[model samples]
Target chain A: MGVVFETVVISFGILYRYNLFKREKERLAFELEINKTQTTLQLIATQEAERKRIAEDLHDALGGNLASIKMNIQNMAPGNTQLSTVVGLLDKASEDVRSISHNLMPPEFSETNLKDLLANYYNQLNNRGSVRFNFHTSGIDRRFNKIDELMIYRIVSELTNNILKHSHATEATIQLIYYEEYLEIMAEDNGVGIAPQISDGIGLKNIQSRVNYLGGKINIHSNSFGTTIIAMVNYKK
Target chain B: MGEKIQLVIADDHKLFIEGLQSILDNHPEVEIADIAENGKELLEIVRKKKPDVVLLDINMPVINGLEALKYLKREFGQIKVIMLSTYNEEHVVEKAKAQGANGYLLKNVNKADLIQTINLVHLGQSCFPYRLPAKQGLPGISDGFLEQSNITKREGEILQLIKTGLTNQQMSEQLHLSIYTVETHRKNIMQKLKLRNPAELMKFIISNNL
Candidate 1:
């Protein structure tokens, strides 16, 4: 009887030890995951800050100088054909700089809300007439925090750009649904769906990273007729 | 027309300001009353000099051109303001217009157009670029005519207005041009197109699909 009782006690002790080990392993994994997220967030923030600095330098220094050069050239010889050609080149250069800087850091990002920014972007795309884009929203009259808004904007931009470049889609739609606790984003396109092999492409990967940073879940559905992507992310009022 | 038009220029770039000054030196009608390096300096100078027109740069230090424009419009309602910036974005232009800017010109504006815009703005007229729709078929056909007839861009613009059957006075008002200038452009258009009269001009316009 004593031997049997000792066996039972030993088994219980072993079982308790195994459970503690498993719990510790899980805690370690969770800590590693948190560290990874923090590192990635820091990297992204640093990259954004660098981009903003470069954009400002480009706009303020290079753009201003180019404008000054054009003005001086025009003043030197108003109607000289050769100077006019140079001015044209300068204008193109200035435009390129402006576009590059604008893309790096949109000037309206700080001033305008997410909806306006997306609307402006969509309007520009529609005006190009290459791909028709429609945006729909519900319960989004209130603005989200800038960081969340920016992340969502990036996700949508990546999705639409992917569609425009690869999906061969003539029409696309982006819908936003805001709930009390979280927001849902759905991007749909009427085109050949994403190829299975290209599902893990850089664009989608970047979007996945953003969604993960936002602590969101994303699902992609693709078939011959079209592709639809849905992402849900929590937000604070 | 008798008194010289007083002007105050505001831009952060000294080189750009000097270039503008050199260009305006040839035009005796426009007198540079004062120059400001930024929006703050601009307000101070405007208050002291009371210039007739202010060439305000959109991007500036301390206070931006748009804000300065608002203050100017509210405090000194008589002073005319023109937004001179490299940014030709539609929203910026709309904001300037909404804030009572008399004219909006890109930084690459030629000397002739710059002087003319200032003069028009001083004459109580507004001058803004006519943004044609992106998908419009008119631009292509208009470009063909311009290339074939050696017509200047300003003439092309006037031709489009003429196609709409606008009178000389109406064209002047819409384009911020004097009636005499409108008549001159009309004569030049007729000469270039070899049209005898307004009827022939209309016929030419239809035949060319311009």
Candidate 2:
């Protein structure tokens, strides 16, 4: 009886320790994986930066040359029909290149107040069609560090575009509230709500990605009323 | 009749700075009031310029974008900020949003979108890619759904990590546990909370203001 009891106790101890050890190993691997993912993400960001740099170079360098060539061609050979046609084609191609380059690099953003820029677009939207828009500002105290404001402005604008295109709504509201500790951005619209059974969502996914990148939380409500996105961003300087 | 949208952009990249300047230079109304190379320079400029909007970057050289943003937001609560970055990391975006960025956008965003956001920000609007929140909640949160019966210390650790944006592998490495153990802990957490997936977890955090 005593030997049996001792054996039982020893086995339990062995099992507990084994489980603990296994858990430890798993944790180490998990950490490694997280590190790997972070590194991968960093690499991706670097790649994106490089791509933008190339686009910028192409725009300033190649774009300039192309524009100048078109100018020279136009100046020299309006009389030469063949040359004119060729130059016209080249000019069209150059315009396309410039557009593509601008798309890749995002030129106008860097120089403006991100919020104002977005608001201008919203104004345009409000002016153009029938979408009744209301934009409110609350947390107007804390201006972001370099390059931060543009990101915020762009994201808000994109959401508005999405709403205009997909929501098919007549009215939308955007609110920016600045809290003592963090910031909150709320956008809502009244239209036909999203279908209940959404399985393969791509736009929502993109929105999710952008929200995730901000390290913010987004709430999407698509009921009979419409779609609402309320995002909360924690302030971590 | 349009409000003068006061603005500032802070970044270290000279080429991008120049490009932005050249483009906005054409906009007769939209003026580039002030531009800085890094976070510190940006802070000083903002202090002086007092623009209504400030565009900040994430990864700067001296103090980094996040830190600078934190400082600025704390000091100037009225100025709106939008975080700009080339990468699209969810957690980073979340962090920026949390830290009070009025908006978030990718560097590869459209020029029209960029202009539109400035207007949006000026108009006092906020935007981001939207996602659902997590469902299952804190240990003692609301509906008594979580087991709350006999959760181990390890289980609690795993929950905290999950809330902090750490993946399963990250939890394992941080806690010195095996992948299997972390997975098991996750299972146990879900089972206890009666939660389904990560979305649920996120929801719970938001509902509880975690």
- Model 1 per-residue lDDT at B148: 60
Score each candidate by Cα lDDT.
0.81, 0.65
Candidate 2: list runs displaced more than 4 Å.
A5-9, A22-26, A29-33, A77-103, A108-113, A116-137, A141-154, A168-173, A189-200, A223-226, B1-210
Compose the digit string of candidate 1's lDDT tens values, residues A1-237: 999999999999999999999999999999999999789878887887888789888887888888888888888876789999998999899988887887777664766667766766676678665887766555644546666677788898889889989998887768676655877777867788889889999999999989988889888877776776878888854
Supply the DockQ value of model 2. 0.02
lDDT tens digits, residue span B21-45, model 1: 8888847789888899889999999
Q: Model 1 chain A, poorest ten-residue lDDT window? A: A134-143
Q: For model 1, state the Cα shift of residue A77 in Å.
A: 2.5
Query: Fraction of true inter-chain Cα contacts (below 8 Å) kept per model?
Result: 0.25, 0.00
Candidate 2: lDDT of A49?
77
Residue A157 miss distance in model 2 (angstroms) = 4.4
Could you tell me which 10 consecutive residues in candidate 2 chain A have the lowest summed lDDT?
A69-78
Which CAPRI level is candidate 1? incorrect
Clashing residue pairs in candidate 1, if any? none
TM-score of chain A of each: 0.82, 0.65
